[model samples]
Target: MSADARERGRIVVGVDGSESSKDALRWAVRQAELTDSTVDAVTAWEYPPLYGSIGWIDAPQELAGDIKGAASRALNHAVKEAVPPDQTARVHCGLAYGTPAAVLLDQARGADLLVVGSHGHGGFAGALLGSVGQHCTQHAPCPVVVVRG
Candidate 1:
């Protein structure tokens, strides 16, 4: 990374393969362009909870790998779909193993801004802001921009 880019600061955005998230990614890119800043496009994943008749069960290692791979692919696809080809160089993709809100918060620690969609895949359809977005806005170390799809 160039010193100029670092001086300009970073913009962290959450991507969840949802329409709303795509909108947020696009918005973040636009803001980055205007500010001459770099963008970190992040997607988070976690092992699904498993249960057996006896009690909670551990997820297979292969299952965990598959889930992480899916998250990676989704992040790439969201970037391809939402970011313009010419401006893609300004965006860096990241995949973290954790809840979306927590991962985003960690990524935004020193970032100039954090961006998220109003609603992701897992939330009430009519809600103005999804749980992740709400949590991020409430707890992020930097300012937040919530984009609507």
Candidate 2:
């Protein structure tokens, strides 16, 4: 890490290509600006479970790659939409293959703050807090901020 990076704080936010996630990204960016911190926007994906007549089956490698690619695209899109062009330099985007909560927690390991949407693409639509958000708030290594969209 560069000396400048070490001196500036880091904020990790989870993005799931959902409206709420976008709101969370926006909130994180504003917070980063105020605190002079850099935002790490992260998205995670996993191969969908396939069911066969015999039992569970592995997803094809090509299909898995496609899913991963989609996740990357979503992360990029979310960052582009949420961050202002002038503030782009303050944001870093990343994608990982894992559960959303786990990936976010990992990214926030040494961060000053962990941010997430109250409700993401998954979970009950009427829920005030999505499963991933709840998990992150409860388990993140750093202080967590749950933004409601």
Candidate 3:
């Protein structure tokens, strides 16, 4: 990587297969184009332990795999749609099992910018800023950009 590439040109974006997240991805891609930066679109997922609590019959391993796979697919699809064909090589996808904010923060280490949607499919869907965006703005190692949808 060139010295500038090694510097503040790596942008990490949080995506959740939601429209808001899609907007954030677009913003990140546009910014990357302007600065010759790269984009890392990340999505996070976790198997809820309460599924069995409600007497639902499902194998733990199978459920975990299904959830993980869906998350990965969502990340891939979002990246594919948001990034232009010419800039596809500059964008990457990351899927992990954890809270959204935590995963995005972990990925933001040494990154030039952390981007997230203003709201997501969370408890406070109508709020100005969802938990992930709020947490990232407060705790990210680098500057955070919350793209409002």
Candidate 4:
């Protein structure tokens, strides 16, 4: 891990290429500006196993690579849309290969705050706090801020 990986006082935000996540990203960036903390926007992705794989026809690595690329692009787009041009330098993006809650918790290891949208693009879209947000709020190592859509 690099020095940046171990940096403290960072504000970690979970984004999933959703409108609510964009709102959370903007809120996190604003909070970071006020607290003089760096914004670390993170997106997580996983390629589930194929339901019925034919013999020697599965390309898990390629599929996983594509998913990772999409996750990276999504994270970059979210940060670009949420962060102002002047403050972009202070914001960093990360793509994790795991569940959103796990990724956010990992990012929150040495962070000051963990921010997430009230309801992301999860199956329970009508809930106040989606599974990822609820999980992070209850399990994050740091304080969690849930931004409503």
Indicate the residue-level lDDT of 54 in model 1.
82
How much is the lDDT of residue 52 in candidate 1? 90
Candidate 2 per-residue lDDT, tens place, 1-149, comes to 88988999999999999999999999999999999999999999999889999899878878987898899899898888989998999999898888999999999999999999998877897888999999998899999999986
Q: After superposition, how far is residue 97 of candidate 3 from its true place, in Å?
A: 1.6
lDDT of 4 by residue, 61-91 (tens): 8688788888889888888888899989878
- The models' CA-based lDDT, in order, is 0.93, 0.92, 0.87, 0.84
lDDT of 1 by residue, 1-149 (tens): 66776588699999999999999999999999999889999999998878999898768878988999999999999999999998999999999988899999999999999999999989998888899999999999999999986
Report, for all candidates in order, the number of backbone clashes: 0, 0, 0, 0
Clashing pairs in 2: none
lDDT of 4: 0.84
- Per-residue lDDT tens digits for candidate 3, residues 118-147, read 988775745778878888999999999999
Off by over 4 Å in 1: none
**What's each prediction's TM-score?**
0.95, 0.96, 0.88, 0.87
The predicted structure with the larger TM-score, 2 or 3, is 2
- List clashing residue pairs in candidate 1: none
Better of 2 and 3 by lDDT: 2
Better of 3 and 4 by lDDT: 3
List runs of model 2 lying over 4 Å from the truth: none
